[model samples]
Target chain A: MEKTGADGFDGFVTARWSALFHLARLLCGGDRHRAEDLLQEALVKLWFAWPKVADEAPEAYVRKIMGRAAARSARRRWWGERPVDRLPELAQTGDMSAAVAERSRLETALAQLTPRQRAAVVLRYYQDLSEKQVAAVLGVPVGTARSHASRGVARLRQILADVIDPVG
Target chain B: MDHFEQELARMMRDSQEYIPFASEQRERLREGVRARRRLRAATVAGGSVLLVAGLTAGLFLLPKGPAVDRPQGPLTRPGTSSSSSPAPSTSSPAVSPTQSHAPGTPTGTGTTGGSSPPSTFPSGSVDPTTFPPNPPATTATAPATSTVAQGTRTARPPVSSPPAGSHSSG
Candidate 1:
């Protein structure tokens, strides 16, 4: 019985590792090292809780844990001290340069958001979760989730407006 | 999804292109789980040792406080029949040392003052009709001293006899 359970847990870990790591990277604001640590911590917790989690959607369970862990790590560390990635110069007007500039501008703006706001935005837009679903994952009220997502997107648009398009 | 939302999804996909998720991380995660379990087991063992030590210390320290301080046996010990009486005074064990000693010292002085008979006498008036039904000062203070000093002293006359047992035992 125990061996089968272990095998199941191992299989789940192997299958979900990449997708969860990708989520973790976005949640960690594209910091590969921090994302690796965050995903590893989430996986460790998932392994220990396999018995309880086996009955539920393991991906959602791990995502919720990762979201909370990322939030907690953000609180403890001075991530705000790290400067934003430099935005491309406004005068470089080539088509290819413009798209790369917009992407970098969007990333820099996303990195500026508070961890909760960023997580809510990523889960709501990137993962295609409803405000209610985002709330469940973030352990917040639906209204709070909606507000975080709206405010995060508004901030991102404001920051990236010149790079993406001058129009709203 | 709105245009901004679609852009966010695209941006996230673009950002995560470089992070390589490896199979070895599963073993790393399992190692972490084992370390956590060991830490939790150590914590439980340490806490249990501390609790057992605390209880053992409490057991030894408790008896050293003087056996007399234990709540007096039963209200039955007083041989008093009034059931309602014990309620107010049952709290007397803790109150005994301070309350009893305060009144006891003055009575001791009064007894030695050659006014022993006046102090010793329970009711000063010969007419029982005029006397209050309860002479609580003597009754209450008497048991308090007796119970409080039981380990070190003998019982004494209830009225105004000085608690020589308390003084001598001290």
Candidate 2:
């Protein structure tokens, strides 16, 4: 039997779901629900464009959509972190707990930066993209992209000072 | 990249949890695609309706051309007086009154002849040569004269000279 468009698309989405979800989570500043929404929206778009982009770079297409949408929504409305006395999730025990705590701290710090800066930083460091690639994804100039990443990293250095100790 | 950058990258990679593509997610994606397709179809249909309606309105709103000025009756022979019939000179007294009242006769000729006093008739009638010369002048001036004279002339009856009235009333 011939492999249909839907089958191909489903397979692609299944294969890349975890990586894309993580990218979305970071893009949305670690809000799981918002990350899911973002990913779902990108997937819907990918389904429509699957015929054209399936053979080429479907993953890149989804990443571009999510990055732009995340930045645009952030600029339109303030999705500020709500301060609470107690933590939402109970602290887990053992080796994984420290990693989870570190991840939480990173997300909290990421949420503090402007949307563009956060997007640039996530694309630069987490995705390991060059400044030009980051610029292409964000639809901005290289200098602008470079500035955003540098400023974002400088801010993160202040926010995560204790978590990431200075090199001896 | 620096030590801090390396650590951040590593932490980002390590923070990702293994998430399977669930049946629930696939269903949701299918539903989302269906909804978007419906919305797009509705938008296209609405735009088409609006475009057709606008074109129809524009077609109706265009200004109409000036009304045609058609001649009211059958084309008359050129150079023949509208008031004068083809009937011979002997039948003049009998035909004159009927021709004057004919619906298609030029209003200017009827009113101009009717407004003249009965005394003016003997000179034109006695010299019969005057009658022949009058046709050309009457035909030329008939159309140029105003029809406003017709309404005023209708109030007073045409004074029929003794000779013509006697011949007709006989």
- CAPRI tier for the interface of model 1: acceptable
lDDT of each: 0.64, 0.72
lDDT winner: 2
Per-prediction DockQ scores?
A: 0.27, 0.72
Candidate 1, B-chain TM: 0.35
Runs in model 2 deviating more than 4 A are: A1-3, A81-96, B64-170
What does the lDDT read for residue A14 in candidate 1? 72
Off by over 4 Å in 1: A78-106, A162-168, B14-23, B63-170
Which pairs of residues have clashing backbones in candidate 2? none
Which pairs clash inside model 1?
A: none
TM accuracy, model 1 = 0.62
